[model samples]
Target: MLTKYPTPKKLAHANLSKLTEILWNSSNGRFGEWKAQELKNLAHDSFGVENCEDIYSMALLTMLDEIQSLAEKADELEKKISSLLKNFDSTITSVPGIGPILDACILSEIGDVTRFRSADKLAAYIGVDPSVNQSGEYTSDHTRLPLPAKSRLDGLCCCCAA
Candidate 1:
C-alpha cells in the first residue's frame, strides 16, 4: 500500500472504497472484500489522526519499515551462521541437553580442545571450576564458582549447565 501512497497523509485522505478495492484486488480475494467501515476504523486507529500534519503516523511507519528490514537481515545472518556451523564435526550437540547454538558456543570458546591438558583445565577455562581458599593449614572448602571474566565463555558454560 505504501507503494501506491508513500505517505500516511496521502493514505489518510485517500478514498475508502478505492483503498478497500485496491486491498481486495491486490490480496487476490484473501481479504474478502473489506468493508469501508472496517477500513475507516483501521485507518483511524493506525494513522492516529484525521489530518496528516497533526500526526506522527509517517514516522511510526518509517520506524516499522526499518524494524522489518533489520529483522530480515538478522534472519539471513542466522541462516548463514547455522550453515557454517553445520560444516564442523561436533559431538557436543549430541549430548542430550545441548543443541546447535550451545554446541557452537562451546566449540567457539574452546577451540582446539587438545590445547587444554585435561578436562579440569577446560572447566577452569570456561569458569566452571570451583574457587578454593586455604590459610595456615586450615582450608576453606570450595563452595562457589567465580563468575567468568570472559563473558562469552560464561555464556557457554551457563548454556551447558542448563
Candidate 2:
C-alpha cells in the first residue's frame, strides 16, 4: 500500500475499511471479510507509532528497494554460477545431496585429488579427517574433526561421514 499512501503516517491514518477494501480488491476477493478483520487486528496490535514522518518513510522505502535489488543480483549471480558449473564433470554433481554450489565449493577447494597421496591425506587437507588421541592403553573415539577456515565446508565432513 506504499504506492497509495507513500508514508507510514499516511498508512497509519488510513481508514480501516478502505485498507481492507484495497486488500480484498487486490487479492481478487481471495481476502474476504475474515481476512480483512485479521489484518485490521494485526494493524491495531502492531502499529504503535502515532506519527511517522514522510522523510523517514522515504528512507525506509529506499532501504527496502536497495535490499530487493541486492537480493535480485545475488539470485542472478547464483544462476550464472550454476550454469557455469553444469559444464564441468557431472561426477561431482552425481554424488547424493551435492548440488551445483556444493560441487563448485569442493572443486574449488580441492583442485586436484591426485596431488594427495591417499584419500586420507585428501580428507585431512579438507579438515574432514577425524582427530586421534591415545594415552597408555586408552584411546579416544576420535569423533571430532577440526573445522575448516571456510565455514561453508565445515558441514562437508559431517555429510561425508554420514
Candidate 3:
C-alpha cells in the first residue's frame, strides 16, 4: 500500500544534515560530535549573545547539531530501552500482543509508562485506538486517526522498527 518509500529516507537525511549544521555552528565546532551536556550550556549562552552575526551563525549551527544529536540519542535510547524492557516484569511485557522490543519503543517515547493513568490513554496516545462516535441511540466506529501528539506518532514508528 505504501508508494513513497524513498521520500522518508531522503527527508530524514536532509533533516539530519540541517540539524548537524545548526549544532556545528552553535558550538563553533568546539563541541565536535559528542555534546549532550554541552548543548545545555550552549542553550544557556544563547540568551546572552550580543552580536547579530555571531547569533545568526550560532542559531543556524545549533539547529543542525540538535538534529544530529537527537537522532543519535534516540537510537541509543531505543537500544537501552529494549534491554531494560526485556528485564521488566509486567503485563505490558507479558501480554500476548506485546514484545520486549515493542515495549521498549513505547517506553522510550512515552518517557514513563506509569505516567499513563489508563490503558485507553496509552492506546490513544500511540494512535492505535479506534475512534468511536455516539449520538442519541446511534453509535459509530471509525478508523484509526492520527495521534494528536507528534511524539506519540514517533513512538509508534519506533515500535514498528522493533
Please tell me which predicted candidate would have the highest lDDT against the true structure: 1
Q: Which of candidates 2 and 3 reaches a greater TM-score?
A: 2
lDDT by residue (tens digit), candidate 3, 103-127: 6655566666678899888777776
Residue 38, candidate 1: C-alpha displacement in angstroms: 17
Clashes of each: 0, 0, 14
Per-candidate TM-scores read 0.54, 0.60, 0.35
lDDT of 3: 0.57
Q: Sort by lDDT, best first.
A: 1, 2, 3
- Expressed as tens digits, the lDDT of each residue in 53-129 for candidate 2 is 66677777788889889999988887888999877764776777776667777888778767999988877777778
State how far residue 106 of model 1 sits from its true place (Å): 3.7
lDDT of 1 by residue, 94-157 (tens): 7888866677677877898889899888888777788777779988865688677577988766
Query: Which prediction has more favorable lDDT, 1 or 3?
Result: 1
lDDT of 2 at 42: 56
* Candidate 3 segments exceeding 4 Å error: 1-101, 141-148, 151-162
lDDT (C-alpha) at residue 37 in model 2:
64
Whose TM-score is greatest here? 2
